[model samples]
Target: ELKVEQNPLFLSMQEGKNYTIYCNYSTTSDRLYWYRQDPGKSLESLFVLLSNGAVKQEGRLMASLDTKARLSTLHITAAVHDLSATYFCAVVDAGNMLTFGGGTRLMVKP
Candidate 1:
């Protein structure tokens, strides 16, 4: 079975601050993805890290993958109210199914 875990399940930040969210998974897979979701909404794809050392950035958010360690990271830069949301990292199994992390909820207060 695959398991994904995220740290600092809840975060409160001030505007213009930065923080990093960590995701760790059990098992081996090079396919990992990051997503964002708003309250009472579906997830929006943020980054798709297909291999080790793969990194992608959009706006104030960045994501990276390290297949070797079965780890992924989502970095938030210059937090803003609009950026407050839940972030998730998922790992794909051989069957192409994903095991998602518990999710990290970020609240940016101005």
Candidate 2:
């Protein structure tokens, strides 16, 4: 069975702070993805890490993949109130479906 784990399942930060969320997977996979979800809203894709060392960044968020370690990371930079949301990392399974980690809910306060 494939399992994905994420550290710090919950986070509370003040606006302008920074943090990193770690995602670890139990199996080998070259593809990883990051997503953000607002309360009562659908998830929004943030970054797609496709290969070893693959990295993608947008605004205050960045994501990276280390296939050899079967790990991925989502980095938050200078967080703002609007950045408060639930974040998730998912690894692509052999069946081409996503196996997502337990989401990390973030609360950014001003």
Candidate 3:
């Protein structure tokens, strides 16, 4: 089984819209992180999912954690073209190695 994976590798989104991205893992983990990257740009922090029921938001994005099921989620609300970017969710295993999801690329239209 894949340690970490995200669905819909590419997302064609719209301005002033809302969407949800899901991340799944094979085993239980405590540390989860959500990061954003724009085209030709470096990574930026959006939220960090640490434990069960942990939720955080910034700007138009929010993230949640569910350690029991080894799942995390990033939810985007009222997206704008400026929100166009790539989103990644990562989880740290027992060995302290961060395992990254395949990533979701979002393209918001004007």
Report the number of the highest-TM-score candidate. Answer: 1
Q: Please report the candidate that would top lDDT against the real structure.
A: 1
Backbone Cα, N, C clashes tallied per candidate: 0, 0, 0
Report the lDDT tens digits of candidate 3 across residue range 1-110. Answer: 33899977999987988999999999878788888888788878777777799999888888888888777888889998888789998888888888889889999998
Ranking according to TM-score, highest score first? 1, 2, 3
- The local distance difference test score of model 1 is 0.92
Q: Report model 1's TM-score to 2 decimal places.
A: 0.97
The residue pairs in collision within model 3 are none
**On residues 32-94, what C-alpha lDDT tens digit does candidate 1 reach at each position?**
988899999999998899988999999998898888888899999999999999998899999
Cα-based lDDT at residue 20, candidate 3: 93
Local distance difference test, each candidate: 0.92, 0.91, 0.85
Model 2 spans > 4 angstroms off: none
lDDT of 2 by residue, 18-109 (tens): 99999999998868888889989998988888889888889998888899899898889999999989999988988888999999999999
Select the stronger candidate by TM-score from 2 and 3: 2
- Report the CA-based lDDT of candidate 2 relative to the real structure: 0.91
Q: Candidate 2: lDDT of 96?
A: 89
